[model samples]
Target: MASPVSSPKKNTRNRKLCTPPNHSLFFLSLLVSMITFFGISVLSFMPISLQDSYLLPLLSPSSEPFSSPSFSSAENRSQVTLASLALTFLDSEENEPILSNSVMVPLPAHGIVGSNVSEEEREFWRQPDGEGYRPCLDFSIGYRKASVRITEEKRRFLTVAVSGGLNQQRNGIVDAVVIARILEAALVVPVLVVNQIWRDKGEFSEIFDVKHFKRTLQADVRVVSSLPSTHLRSRQTIETMQMPSDVSPLWIRSRFLRKLNGDGVSILKLQGLYSRLSKNLPSDLQKLRCKVAFHALRYAAPIRELGNRLARRMRIEGPYIALHLRLEKDVWVRTACRTGLGAEYDDIISKIRGSQPEYLRASQNMSYLQRRLAGQCPLNSLEMARLLKALGAPRSARVYRAGGEPFGGKQALQPLVAEFPNLVTKDNLARDGELSQYSNRSSALAAIDYIVSLSSTVFVPSHGGNMGIAMQGHRAYVGHRKYIKPNKRSMLPLLEDTTISNAEFSRAMRKLHAKSQGQPEMRTNKRDRDVLAYPVPECMCKHSVNNDVSHH
Candidate 1:
């Protein structure tokens, strides 16, 4: 009877399910529902392609969500990494000879020109049929093809011509020779003087092996280089020949020397060298189309292999950055500013730090302590003052803040490492125990790749002086936006050329605003929507370093 009475009240009205007193389930369900609703709404507004490509496929596997696109991939900018770039090497496909045309131009006769052939010279090419045309064209082409083969194979290698031009008392052709050795080329023939030096049985020979050349053909090749001559006769020889532009002999003559007609021995030596190289050259040389093309096929493989080996030994991996610190010589010594090398280090660090994400700048600068701790008698305070003063530092400022101090050689590096914790200064790349200096190509390139890997920004001081074309070409390949220095010879040109357009200017302004909360006003005078500009840095200005630092 009591059960019947309770059941009677349960019938009349339908009551909704009210949650229990705790209501934990109710709150959780409500939270889930709200999240779902918002997510669905957001998805609806997103691009249909994006939703189909990512979200919907991730969530429901089949549902089409976003139906429109108002965003672009380009606008969604992100930092480019070394892995992503993969070190692209553009080829000079145009330079490649199209075997399509067999109508080749005849090469000029060199030996018996003007019927002034001396008895010795005439005897050199004395032939049975009264010196029948020596097939100079065919010989030249064949030699070129052989050199091409060598270039192609070594495209993975550096074609370093060790002319007397690149050699010195302390830094011999050994640096370039060692680089060639490290690359493991199919052949390594020195150009002109460098070859002579390499072949010498002196102290350098004690350190290097002339026997390596025994597997060689007559290692003679005259390479026209971009250097001034000591003798008027040499200069006249240089002035007489027509310049050709392919990486072939003609190309070398055309591109490297301003004019041709140099010494016969030099030219013959060069041809001989090429012939020797050709004899030993592999088929891979034919594949090389550009200077950069060789880098991809040849140099990078060795560098990458070396880098990977280094990483494995050091317990690191793919994400490492290369740093080439040229502590040996002043790269900018005779040119623009006679500043110390320390400033270059500072410049390198600043550039590296700026482009790197906040997380990567974890390293520090330590040149100071290294200099202090090096075991020489501590410089008297006066000696220190003079050194600092010579380095263009204000005596009142701290030694660390003293800007533009030359690295007193590699001694400066000790302090640099202390300052930067994760800084790697390993230079053990040579199979041939040669130290890398600023002028060393292999070292420079290795350092380039390292720095590029570590940081997005790279700072190359200037193109003048010893900065080689190979290095410049490398930087350009890696997306380096170049900034040339403005010297005393050109101000109006600098100002005239610095202009930018309005659309670009506007976008830059907007980007700056989006990234910064309170930026100062632009100091530019041009208000035209289509015109804009940027200034060269103080370092590049002709008014002496820091003279008008405020402009920077």
Candidate 2:
């Protein structure tokens, strides 16, 4: 204003001051432009199904859409802008449907409605990216598959007789193959030995496809339906070695390796091979475990057909939760916990545990509440009811009961049925004569449950057991399907607190399990941890586009 062009230095200083403001304005416009562009790009590239799911909330805010965001708000607009850019990076490939029953697309933090859930509760339920890791089954850079070079003449034989239930037998069979590879021996089909207590005479061929089993493992280890004629006739040479549980490769080699090498064409039968092998092993061996569980050990066609039929029926209406209602008599007595039926049932369980000293746990000294609090006991119906409700499942949620008959029958399930009226099992879901065929075969029925459970929208185990553990791992391998492992030990205390309101309880439950959902965690080196049940660091690799999710 002081004679506009009079002082050149004054004019320059004023222009420099104006330059900073202009620069700021330029950056602000660029950020807003970039954010708008990114958000639009995400919506444009989204699948038709995902577009409906993610955009419906924005069009109509009455769903409490903004209340619990998939991605929480950033501290500032800059952070918001940065987050908008993140949508462009999800690589549309990750948005494909995993299975028909699974979430149409596994959005990082997509939330379901109507129930009171945490901001990122749906993320907890969503299958993990395994920290960007997916299932990878291959030898490392140095490791290579050297198929059995030992001639048939020098090859020894290892036959395993797996005991317990269907899942126990599965664990044993998986270990048997790795054990065969470790010992450099040909593996005969693992026998599903009769459980002395249950007297279940289920055969290997009755459950699994024998030819498929043989063909699948042919490359890694020589597999046959039976041992040679000589060994079959004179089975005495094949000592029935009752192997101790949790045996290591070193122990296996020392115990049987030298013995097998001594005799020409020696055949050894190992009993109690359930959990007989170490959890930790070489990467190649772990991959073999996955190949065995996911690929080789398939249920017979009939079992699969029935299971699929039930699964189809389950998901026909909508997504369902497969609950491993672990309230069996054996589970009760094993943990010595009250049946919640009454003091009478508790006394009966105690007497059974007392009379059968073997059923008496090493932790027998711990009281029933102590065991329940420690999560050693299966969750009874009431606790399960509370859990499902707290986890965002409404009263109308369809639930598939995935266990044998509860000890107390309808009375035991009253609480759960009261909450989730649409509860069902293979019995009700199957066709007229479908379940009748496998009514007596407990393992076959369990196999049916396993099949249906694996395909469920969500799998919630009442307590940790063979079926539950196996399902959790299988779900993770399949597509990181929603597997809610109840925070029993921790949540039990919270659940027991009567003073705490329902709102408080729900918040606590969600918070406790925030990071426990089927995330990519490597199997701990703990004893008896099944690799098939925890196949992240070993079996699964990162950004595994080649690894396809197994719907079967």
Candidate 3:
């Protein structure tokens, strides 16, 4: 009844409903319509598969797939959504393969693997309206990986050599093989420098020192140039042999070779020296003997080779000491060779071990001897002496009585050097620089000079070869400054085991020399006795000898 009266309020309400919308509402309606239109347009423009599989389900709850999550409550739905989105993006071939193959492309910049990716690939993923797919983890797994690349390169090319005093015993080649494989260096060739050559060449014969030929023949080898002072320091005699036109023993001296090539000097000097040195030499001296210094040489060959390589590759900027391990075989052989003799090798070894207390040390700390003798029983006196010396003990300490009496339990004369500082100090190197080779004689001399300048001490073998290089290159001073741990005097173990007796050593050396040279009438007199009998004598004359031999 009241509505039928047509009151002003009722009339206004009806007018309001009937009238067109105000400007605000009109604009709002236009905006809302435009938004809806655009939404529909975007949905239509999507890929057929995307629209059917993703956009439609997202916009319309009716089309949303039902997931029967097994958990009691859907607490991590947001996390699930994010994971789902990641999976969806990666599912596409165009996206997943991009990241996988990225590692194969050559790195644009030289940086560690953990740093920056290629710029083009990075930009490709930064789209404004894209279905956001940014990788959260740094992923690198392929040829570029450090492990893979190193292995591949190692399989390419390599050669290894094991030589004893310039290709002697040939056993060191074993170590070369072992270390080469461990470093992943692909070595295709293995060379053995036989120690037998030295014996055949005679102790002091010209051809006995075949180091030059061996060293020049191949570049890849672990060569030992360490021999007795008698051999190394002795005046070198020469023998002539057929040579290639461009190659000559005279070329041993780098400076001389360059000068001769430059001035076209005749190689008559080398020919003359060779003829004089080789004249009337024994058949054994005509060829190199690989026995006398082979043990130490073979063992150290790899390390020396590695040292040279490291010097070249890493540009080492310091002096390096090549500490030879002559204590074991040398000591045992000497000790066992002279049983009742006053200068028994075992007694000497015992004295040497006593001088260097480390000889008596147990295998607790990780010294070379400890590592080698771990879980093994105690070593003999010679073995102990060798171990002590190898651990870098002082060599000046006394190992024998003044009047040739046996100091049975004397402490090591040398100080232990296991933890000695400055073993490889930069200050120790000579300011004179690297070795040069020109004439064979000069080159040999230069090599000696280089060794002397580089090393503070030269550990020589008892018989010979050490003297050859030492005397020629001024390295003889180095040997004199240090004690010579005689090889023949040390105790020797059984054939399979490393034990020794003084008497056994003398017999072994005599037999080794005779058997090696095929000379049944060969005899070593007081020279051998003097070498095997006494500790390396200190130089008394003022020959400018350096006597600053530190324990370490």
Which candidate tops TM-score? 2
The lDDT ranking, best first, is 2, 3, 1
The whole-model lDDT of each prediction reads 0.26, 0.70, 0.28
TM-score for all predictions? Answer: 0.27, 0.75, 0.20
Candidate 3 lDDT over 363-404, as tens digits, reads 335543343333222233344344334423333321211111
Model 1 Cα lDDT, one tens digit per residue, 329-378:
22221111222334665565445445643423122343333322331112
In Å, residue 448's CA in model 1 sits off its true spot by 10
Q: Is candidate 1 or candidate 3 better by TM-score?
A: 1
The candidate 1 region of ten consecutive residues with least summed lDDT is 530-539
Residue 275, model 2, lDDT: 75
Model 1 TM: 0.27
Candidate that scores best on lDDT: 2
Q: Give the poorly placed runs of model 2, Cα more than 4 Å off.
A: 1-130, 140-145, 150-154, 230-236, 524-529, 544-552
Q: What is the C-alpha RMSD of each candidate to the true structure, in Å?
A: 28.0, 15.3, 30.7
